[model samples]
Target chain A: MINFEEELKRFFPSLEIEDSEEAIYRQDMTDAADLLLGVIREDYAGYSETPTE
Target chain B: MICFRCGAPLSESDFCNACGVDVRRYKKIVYAANSCYNDGLERACVRDLSGAEHSLKQCLKLNKNHIEARNLLGLVYFETGETAAALTQWVISKNISGTNNLADEYIDRFQSNQSRVETMSTTLKKFNKGLELAQGGSFDLSIIQLRKVLSMNPKYVQAHNLLALLYFERGDFEKARREIDRTLDIDRGNITALRYLNEVNAHLGIPDDKNSKGIRIFDNPSAQVIRSGNETLIQPLNDREPLGLGAFIQIGLGVLIGLAITYFLVVPAKERAAQEAANAELYAYGETIDEKNATISELESRVSALEQNNITLSDSLAQYEGSNGAVDANNYLISAAMAYIDPNQDATQVSEYLELIGDDYVETSSSYEFKELYTYLLNDIGDSVAQNYYDTGLSYFNNGDYTLAISYLSKAYMYNANNDNALYYLAMSYYESGDISTATDKLNTLIESFPTSSLVDKARQRLDEMSY
Candidate 1:
């Protein structure tokens, strides 16, 4: 048996078309270079604290 | 590979052969960049522009001057309708190589067609206007504008993505899905489109597996909550086990029965339903493709029409740019006023410019000021023109050239319709030329227009003589 109120909440009011202006403004394009750089930085940061082999 | 420390080529050993610099890490980086470039090239060959873009970016990060990767990235961008960005990349590539970059060919292709370049410029303007409209809360107008932009550049992924976002904001998940799918078709791994597709699927209640790519991307804590008769049930997807003793037996029996039922009835029924749904979706998509083709046909015709109109407008604009009748008229009026102020200043230039403005301009005008100016100019110069035409007409009439005589006499009558001699000579030219019907019409016009004229008697005499 499905809950009626929960089902109703699934249909959230759509964001206004004007709100897309801010959405686009806030949009940051990310590609694999950024991902690779981030991952490398994270590994480098954690590598210093690792125990020596 | 080259040594980073001393700029010397290295052998296969860990150290540079010439400079003895430790080049292992540098060599590894270069290898990794090459590998990424190779991956990008492979993906680009298969037209996976989105994935190719990503791999190429990673390659450039590792080695900024990876020429082939950079050029391929520009090509991918061009295919996706980012012409400016593609041009920027190719320019950089050309600058880096300076001699034999394929980017040069791409740049040349873009520059070769003037009309196509102008259309691209118009497309970009329309896209920016659409973006402005979307920001200003005019989604319908924005969508219409974006459709035009797409018609101009079908692979414009940004327009498709923005249109999809608008559809999503309108709660039209199906349209949003359609638009996102089109974007993905151009660039298969476009993250924005993929994200939108996930959202649309969720809104449509298409159940995804717990470990699906979209679900794992977010790492949702609660997969789903099953509420059976007001009792909240939590069944962790990762943890399910057989119950103990009688519960296990009953569960096993239930599972067996469920499997039996599924095998016997549900599977074939579900397959049939799925096939029907797929067929319906295919038909709907076919209709959509037909509509798009029709729109493209209409847009092509409209573009040709607009191009022709542009040529005509350009010619008309050149005429305006060369010399304007209105400006000449204003100048003449000013010169005439100046001449009125100074006795020494002659106003012949005024009549000259007024003639340039022409009688057609004066007669069609509804402006009282222009009419007054025209009347003032005409009162000063009109009698002279009528007299000139009368003199020319009589000369031509004496020369026995009735055609030239009628042409000038008609002009004399047009300028000064009250000229009885000009009208009589024009009618006589017509009669002598054997156009008796036109001569009769002209004589009748003369009598009706100037009933008290002395020429009316001669006109009646000619009419009676012609009748004889």
Candidate 2:
């Protein structure tokens, strides 16, 4: 038998039109490519920070 | 594609040509995003909106700057009736690619009709409310709210799944199956709809397809598992052999209950209908009686009015036959005319008939012809009628019958005003009748009116004697 309470918990409230602006503002736009670029930039900064090589 | 380091284009090598930076991983990420976008496009074309949404979101996670994947995700969201979510994706897509972007067109189309936006807003609000109600354990109210939401936006997969879940919870397996079927029609690979369909199918005793996708999303513990030679045979424990005697007895009890229901519900309904029909007929009869009574009263009033009219007409006829009435006066004139026309009839007969036509009738009447005719007849017999009256009055006066004398003398004087003999006798009759005042008046009239006559001196002598 379907546990109605357990099943109902899966459904979340749909976003309303008024909340769309806030949702868009709070969205995480960071992607895998951005993470890769962040790693590469950190590596370049670390190399420049090291003593003369 | 542009390099992240210096905004320079890349080459076939593992590095950006202008920036001299490694771009092999970045190119792999772009290629992976492109591959995901291709998969999503294929899934969307096949109407697998749920699969498409997964692929498109994966593409966006790999490369958020993928405009095509982002636009497709918005379309998938719009198709599923998540307008605000779709608009969020499109708005982000447009911000990333300001010009020559498909998101611009999508946003323009969505925002063109103000009423459509308002309707979608209402649909979303109702769906959220339904979800809230469901979470609060008000399943029935949630079902009603979700039904309204689906009526406004039928492609809303979330609302359909929620409504189907509600039906399943309420044990309405057939209705739950229908809502799930509608949800699957919109989003074929929807996991929620598939799960609900599985539950509904199990409740309805429909055999589940072994190879169907998402069929085993929820495990049914009531099924007995039997393993035989690398194959598992699952049998539902609830499917039982029928109880021969107990089932028959239950069927018999159901038939008896049906008959009882027929007797309790149907029989009274038929009797009430009969009673209502009888009451309606009685009310109609009463209305007809009231209408007939109204007609009778109207006719009675008409008859009463006619009776009053008849009485007024009778009174009018009686007035015409009275002493001074027009009918009586007309008859007297007609009689005088008839007597005057007869050769054997004496002037006395015509004169008496003319006297019957009262002086008031001749003077006050409107008929000129009647007055002219009466005057002509009176003048024709005036001299003889006056002489006869004067002789009768003189005889009556000498016989001491002053009343008789006065009556005849009055007529004689009325017919011929110039008759001195009639005037003298009329005055003498009044003197003998104990009317001294009237006698004096007549004597003075004779003296003033006929000064040259021998009766004038006699009249003056009578007047002087009356004064003494």
Candidate 3:
């Protein structure tokens, strides 16, 4: 048997037109490629820091 | 594929040719995102929208620059009545790829029609209100609000699912099942609707058949689902067997009682419902008529304003047309030009026509053709006209008519500035008229314009006397 109150709690309020701007601004756009680039750039920076003997 | 760092086009090699960064992993990430997008597209084609939504989101999470995946995800959101969510995804996608992006078309399609946007906005508001009402333990009011929302936008799956939940809570398993069926009809892969269907079926004691999945019972009361071993059968739920005489008498009595009850109770309630529907329809028609009347009144006022504007413009236009207008001035100038070119017409006739054109036309109106033609004609006969006016002025000056002499001499000097005698006589006439200021001006003009004239010493003596 489904619990009506508990099931209703799963439903969230819809994003109104007024709130769309904030929702878009707060949306996470970071992807796997972005993460990989960040990691590679960090490693490259660290590698360049080593002195050439 | 493109390089993540410099945005350069990728080559077949594992490294970027431009920036020299290793791109083997980046290619793999993009390839994986494309695979997710393909999976989402397949799911979407099969109307498994929830599955499609999940795969598309995974694609976007892997590659936020995947515009196709974003657009498909937006479509999925729109299908599930998440219009604002759909708009956000499309907006982000448009920002990610500005040109030749399908997101631009999708956003334009959704937003170009203002009425559709308003309907969507209102439907969303009512759905939200319904959800709030449900949460506040007002199940009946929520059902009514959700019904209204669904009536406005029948394809709103979320509203249907919420209505189903309300029905299920109110112990209306049949209506709940119907609502769930409608939700699934709009979005086949709506998991909430499927789960609710499962619960409603359980409550109604309907036999669950796992073989034919997603099969929903419609409003057919006689239709039955039966599983015989591995196969399913759909026969009538209440199949009437042959009845004996006693059974017939009992059925006939029951039918009579049913008719009596229906006539006494159900007919009146049905009539009230019909009357309410008619009243509601009449109110809708009244609102429409009022809106049309307002539009008609606005257009009528606009027409009246335009007519008034037309009358004012016509009046203003008429002032620049006709006998006392610019046309008359132009005609006078044209007549003067014609007379100057005529072999028989003298300078006096041309001068008379030119005077008819008036000073206002020459001083105020800067007509290019008028100025050109008038200047040419005046220059052609200026010397002869000056001699005529100078003779007339000398006669007037000797007769002691200084005002008439001044007028004629001024015309003579105006026609030909080289007539130094005309200038000297105009100064003498102004001096005799006792207008010392005018006399001084004419005397100075005579001395400055004609330095070799015999009147220079006389003009200097007069200026000295005026100063003293």
Score chain B of candidate 2 by TM-score: 0.47
Please give the lDDT score at residue B180 for candidate 3. Answer: 83
Model 1, range B108-203, lDDT digits (tens) per residue? 998999888777777767877887777777989988998999999998888888888878887888887788878877887777777777787688
lDDT of 2 by residue, B243-276 (tens): 9998999999999999999999999999999999
lDDT of each: 0.74, 0.86, 0.86
Clashing pairs in 3: none
Model 1 chain B lDDT-worst window of ten: B209-218
Interface RMSD of each: 12.0, 3.0, 2.8
DockQ by candidate, in order? 0.02, 0.40, 0.35
For each candidate, what TM-score against the reference? 0.40, 0.51, 0.52
Best by DockQ: 2
* Inter-residue clash pairs, candidate 2: none
- Which ten contiguous residues of candidate 2 chain B have the minimum total lDDT? B209-218
Clashes of each: 0, 0, 0
Off by over 4 Å in 3: A49-53, B210-468
